[model samples]
Every structure is written in C-alpha cells, then in structure tokens.
Target: MPTATADVLDELVRASALLTEANSVTRLIAAMVEQANDITRSDLAAFYLRTDHSEEVSFKLSYRRGRLDSPKELATNGELVEFLEESEESVVLLERKNSPFNELLLDSNSASGVALPLVTGRSLLGVLIVNSREERFYGRARLQFLDSLARIAAGVLNNAQLYRELQEHARQIEELQRYQENVFSSMTNLLVTTDESGRVHYFNRAAAERFALDEARVGLTLKDIFGKGLTKDVFKTIDTVEQNGQTVLGLEGIYKTDEIDIDYSLNIAPLQGKRGRHEGLTLIFTDQTAESRLKQEMKVVSEERRLIKDMFSSYLSEDIVKLLVENPDLVKPGGGARNATVFFADIAGYTNFSEGKDPASIVKILNEFFEEAEPIIRRHRGYLDKYIGDCIMAVFGVPVDAGEEDTVHAVTCALELQMLVNSPRRTFFRGEAEHLRIQIGMHTGPVVAGNLGGSRRMDFTEIGDTVNVAARLEGVAVAGEIIITENTRQHLGDRFSLEERKPVEVKGKKKPIKIFNVIGIDQQSA
Candidate 1:
C-alpha cells in the first residue's frame, strides 16, 4: 500500500523467482541478501547465519556486499554478538552493541545502523544489519521499510539456507565418491563387498585385474567363483562365515591354478547395516608376496610347537597332536575356561635315559619315539595338546569334534605305543627297550581355552584342575601304563576295564582324583 511496502513486495517477488531457478542455497542467499540490501536503500549491509557442528555453533555469511568473499566461508564469531541479543527488541538504531561490526562500522565508516535478529524458536539463525552514513538515517518510514523488507527476506533466506545445505551435502558426497574411486582403483589387494544374501555388490579394480576377470563374470554368487574354481579357500571361508556368523580374517592358503602357485590371504568381516544389523561381508584379499613373508614369520613361531607336537605324538596320540596343530587358537593358557577334556602322558625313565645318551642321539631317539607313536594317536581321533620333556599330553574332542571313541582311542593309542616300542623300532631305542616306558593319563573335563600370552610372548595352552589332575595321574603312573581318571573311566563307560587305582593327589589339585588302570575293551575281551 505504501512506497516501502510496494518496494518490499517487489523484492519478495524477485527473491521467490530467483529461489525457484537457484540450484544451490548459496546462490539463493545471494539473491535474498542482494534484494534486501537494494530495497532497504542501505549504503552497507551484511548477513550472518549459523550452523551447528554438534553443540558448537559457528557462523557463515549468508550474504554480503563483497562478491569475492564467500559469505558461506566467512567466520562471523564475536562479530554481531549484541545485535543477536536485541532481535526481539523493537529496534536497535545507531548504537553500538559491543560488537566488532558495531565498532568497525563506527571506526571505518560514518554509518548509522539498523539491526534485527532472524529469530526462530529462541534460536538466532542469523542477524541482518543495514548501515547508512547520514545521521537520523532511519525514520519510521525507513524502519518500517527495513522491517517490511526483513519479513519477506527472512522467509526467502530460510528457503535459500535449506537449499544451500542440501547442495553442500551433495558436494561432500561427490568428493567421497572421488575418494572411494581413487582408493578402490589403486588398491593392490583385492576388495570385494557382497549383499546381505551373499550376492556380489562390489569388486575393486585390483580384484578384477588380479583374476583377469571379465565384466561378464563380476556380479555372480560365490558359487559362480567356485564354478570357475578360482579358489577353494575363498568359497570355504565364505561358507564358514555364512553358516556360523563368524568374522574370520587372515586366511593364507595356496591356490593351485594348474600349478601356477597363487597364494592369497583373505580377510572376511561382516558388513553391518543400518541399526547395527549384519548386512553382509566385505573381503580384502592380499596376494602372495606379502603372504610369503607372513608365512615365514608364522612358520617360525609355530615351528617349536610343531616340533613339540611331532615328538609328543611318539608317546601319546596323533589325534591329539593334530588337534593342537589344527586349532591352536582353541587352547589358551591360564584361561580356566572349561572345554571338553584333559590329557597327560610321560616317557617312563625319560629323564634318566637322557643322561646316558649323547645329546644328538637323545634328540634323534626322542624324535624316533614320536615317529613310532604317531599312527595309534590318529586312529583314535584326538588332539595332542602339549609335550613336557618326554611326556606327551593329549586330548580327544578338542579343537574339533571328538567322536564317541575318545576312551577307546586313548586306550588303543596306549597299547599301540607299547607295542611299537616292543618292535624293531624298539631296537633303535634300546634305551627305551632296556628301561624307559610310557604312561598316559586321560580325563575328560573342562579346561580354560583362549589365546594366552604376556605383553609380548604367549602360548595357547590349557590350565585347570582337570589338566592338573591328569598330569598328577601321569606322574604317579608306572611306565608302560594306560592309566585313566574316574571321569575318563565314566566316559569310557565300561568299554574298557579300568582297574581302580587309589585316589591320588596331584600337585596344585585341592583334592585327590580317582585314578585307574585302563585295559581290555569289549573288542579286546573278545
């Protein structure tokens, strides 16, 4: 109706049209601030808007006269402090608000000021200030004029702010895409992502190049990879993870593609979905060169345990040694967690016999003893957990499924070890033939299990009352003996004649465990 309202209406019309065509919020805000300044007839004008990064608030200029300065990039902290405090005030005219903008306007330019806050629910989105050089610069005509302009401009600026934020988000996403492309394309390791149902979602460029894979074959199921027989380890790891919900990583295995040795180390992890759901799996597969160095290191580490297992098998059982080797991750030291069984064995007179033999011969004979004892252990399907000196400790149903024959297997291995020592192999171990004997003590019970180590060195081993009692029984056992515990006897369930031995206290065990002499099963009796 009035000139100011008419001019304000014109700016509102122009702001709306510019907003409609504006692809970005920055452009829209430029339109809003520019039109607001024009209609208010201000000599100088600036607008500051706020954004949140968590609880902390920072300011970006929504619009300013300097086109070269990105209004969005300028930090407006400590600049318009009091101006914001007075947004609800009917007016703040030509008075400093203890703000830098107020002081700067007074110092650098003789400008009278009119400032207002853009208030939304007690939060200041921004402030707009118009400055003119002439005194009594704003009348009721001018304040009404600026207020009219602020009203229309505020709504337009609100829309522009939304548009700008959305545009900035789109930009961030594009940059992230570029980053992903750069990383994925150049990675030396194979990278793959699969959907919730095991369907292929992404395979990096390295994976494609390493496999010489064609696009026609990229998005198929794991079955397709197996159909091509690209890798058995890949399919096996995938199947294991899918079936068990285990996140497995670092699987190193050789790939035989017509005798071209391809070694791969695979890392498999579950992909989490929105809301912490397991969506699928992602894999990073490293090829042979790095794998070889790692294998060398691992081989060195496992070498001692492997040797210990090899020698222990001579006196104990193959099943147990295999168990130790196959599931090293299963046996952790000092865990006190019960698994399934505990086993112990010792070479009778091993300590005394070693005194007479040369060091090399002792090593050789011990090795031979183990070689002689290997088969009977495997026949029983058990795991040899560890060996102490000539003593061999083994257990069934550990690190893997232990069949029902655990007791029979232990008995059978004992008999075989004795029988083997009696053979010509016994001739090579004349010391064993002359005096030394072997004893096995087995008890089925729980033992702690997990990876055990210090801040640095560690070993996977079982330490519990079960393990302690088993070792005690083995220590008291007479050589060439097959002694089992009451628990093992029960597990054996009369399949073997376990002649009751007196309850004996083993070291570290609070109470004595019932020990027995294990002999003839039903098959043995027949």
Candidate 2:
C-alpha cells in the first residue's frame, strides 16, 4: 500500500472506534462531519440525518475556517440528495455550477465538491457533502476514505437511536412503579405481602400503623409480627392456599392484646407471577371490631327482652306480654279509669287451719293451692294482680280490654278455684286440713288500673271502690262458695248459673251491695 493510503486506513480505524463510543446521535453526527472534513481536506462539510418523515432530513453544516451553524431541514428530492439515496459511490462535482450541491455551500465560493451517502447494508441513514474551493478537490483516495467514514457513522447512529428508546422505556417503567407504590401506601385496610417462605417483603402504610410495625419489620416472618397466637391461624390459611392455589377470603379472628382485642376479617390470596406461577401471598385485614361490638350489645338486649316477656307472661296473656316487651313505653307510670272485673279468692278458715301447723307447712299448702289456681285465671285471660297471704287478687279487662267477656272469664276463673279447693286432687290438704275450702268474690265496675307506685318501685294492679267491693264480698263468703256482685252479674249475660244472695253491707259504702252465689257455668254457654 502507498504511504498516504496506509495513513488513511489507520485514521479510519481510529475514527471508527471513537464513533462507536459516541452515545448520542448529535455527538456522533458532529464527530463524523469533522472526520469527513479532516480526511478529505474540504473547506466545508454538511451532514444530513434522515427525519422521521422520509421526504425530509435535518442537516448540520460545518466550515473548516468559520463557526458552525445550527442544523436546518431540507427536502430529500434535491439532485445531490437523490444521488446519495440511489448510489453507494460518492458523486463528485468538478466545478462550481448551478447544481443542488452548490446551493448547500452557502456563501462559500466552492469549485468542486463530493456527496457520499451514509449507509449500512442496504439502508440509507443520511447524506454527507464536502465542498472545496479548488477544482477536483475530492480525489479517488479522499472519496474512498469519506465512504468508509459514512458506513461507520450509519452504524453508530442506529445504535444511538436504540439507546435513546431504551432510556425512555426505563423512565416509563420507573414512573409506573412509583404510582403503584403510592396506591398501596394510601390504602385504608391493612395489607401485607410475603414471599413463599413467609417472610414479609411489603407492608403498606396502614399495616405499619395498625400493627405498630416499622421499616425493619420488612423481611421478618409473620410469626414475628403477629406473635404466636394470631400467626398460627394465618399460617394455616396460607398453607391451605398454597395447596389449592385458591384465594381464601373473610377468615375471621380476634387479635388479642393486653389492652383490647381487635376483631378482623382476613383475606389471603396467592400472588401470581407473569407466567401464572405462585410467587407469594398477599394478606388483607379488614377491621370488624365496631360491627362485632354492636352485634354483642344487640344480643344482650334480646336476652333482657326475653326475660321481661317470661316475667310478664306470668301475670298477663301471651299477646299482651309481647306488646309490653316490644314497646316498654306503653307501661310508663300512669293510671286511668278502666271498666274491669276484679276477682278475689281467699282460703276459708285459713287462720284456724294453720293455727297449730308449722309456718313451712302452711306456706307449702298455700303454694300448692295457688300453683293449681293461677293457671286457671291465666287460661281465662285474667291477670293475677297479687297474692295476699292466703288470698289471690286477679283482675280482667284492665290493661287489656276483653269487653263484656271480662266478667264472664272472671266468674269462670272463680268457679275453677272453688272446685280446686273441693277436688280430691288437693292431696297437700291432709288430715284436719282436708276439709279446707276457698271462697271467691268477683265485681265488675269502673276502677283505676295501671303500673302504680313511686319511682323506686312499682306494681301493675287495680284500685277503687270496685276492688274494695270485691274484697268485702269475699270476706262475707263461706267455704266452697263463688260469689259475684250485681255489677258483675249484669256483664255475665246469663253465661253462668247464679242464685241471688241477700244484700251485703260493705265497709267502704253506705248502701248494702247485692251479691249472688255462682252455681256453675250454664252447660250450653260454657
């Protein structure tokens, strides 16, 4: 090889290495323009890089002796640009003429110039032009060196474009990761993500605050954070998910601490990778403490209502007891005049029968009698008002109205009580007490009835002349007798067989009250 040709090859080798090292398209294009000017000894050099549009190109022009101008765009259809696009060989302009190559020289008085296409394989990246003041400035060797330099520039430009696209992709991926982290941290429910080995890798802001965890808690096992008590249940759920590859939702449990117990519903799901493989587990905890406390309070209220119903059922009918329990305000402290039938039943000769008996024996006999008698009153829709020693005061149609039937039910209840005293089923009445009998008196009239008493205590009962008249009648009755006043008899409407008794003087009234003996319920009316 000639000395000049050897030097050119050596310079081309060095330029290729430097161009390959250039990381940006602008820097590589500027370096290539400089190298073209140096190797060809041209007065002016311009490099045109293909724009995104195939018909236009952006060009940077440099002069060997003057300042560099900023890049400008030009149409690809120009004579010189057309030659560069079609031909691999450099086009040499021997003299300054009215040619497209002369226009690119600008104000420079160029005599000759050369245009070479920067191409790799079959693809043209751009065109490189060099102009000189002297004629035949681009010799065979100079054109060869410029062509070699264009190939290196084309390869380097392609790599630079790829590098810029990769940088943009990396930036977008980083922004997406930041957005996902913000969404996770802003969640209200506690969230935790753990690796297959159960080591926590991600704990969101809510999980950190709720569990009192810090950054150091990351990489810790679930056992360390939840302690042994709760971790055992969590691990069991995780194991089940692992075996089945299915999500488990709403596993309820209590997280206990010294101060309080937190009720939560946990959801555990398998975290899947891109290829549908299980990578880890994600745990979400929803706090249910407030809801659980509300349910427990309602349960207690329901139990208390049941107790109230049971206690009230003993005195009132099932329907009335239900109404009173559901609407407690209905039984507020107040009284009103209501037409009611009051029945008073007293054990005859009770003081004489218990004169020599022990107190326990007397109580036992009274309890047995009242036990058999109270149900008969309740069965007739009569409210057992109170028990006074050996007497039972029952009322009908006060808190709940039964209309005229109230007097009939009261009279029927009194007859059942008298039969109970005389029946052979009274086994507790033994020896001398076998002949014990009961007398009942019923009166129907206007009476004050309601829950009556002071704030500290109260009882639902009736009070007035009607209740007093019934008690007075019971005082004058003999054993095995059922008595009723004329007021009660009028309401009975011939439902019971009655025998009129002589008028009885009552303590509370000046006039004597007419009373009757209840023989029995009329067979057909019963």
Highest TM-score against the true fold, candidate: 2
* lDDT of the structure predicted as candidate 2: 0.78
In candidate 1, residue 82 scores what lDDT? 52
Please write out the lDDT profile of model 2 over residues 305-349, one tens digit for every residue. 775575467887787787767875545446788899998888898
Model 1 Cα lDDT, one tens digit per residue, 428-493: 467444566677776777767544669675555656667777777777778767777777777665
Name the runs in model 1 displaced over 4 angstroms. 1-8, 15-34, 48-80, 86-112, 120-122, 132-145, 158-163, 230-237, 250-261, 289-526
lDDT of each: 0.65, 0.78
Alpha-carbon RMSD, candidate 1: 22.3
Candidate 1 local distance difference test against the native: 0.65
Candidate 2 TM-score to native: 0.46
Predicted structure with the largest lDDT when compared to the true one: 2
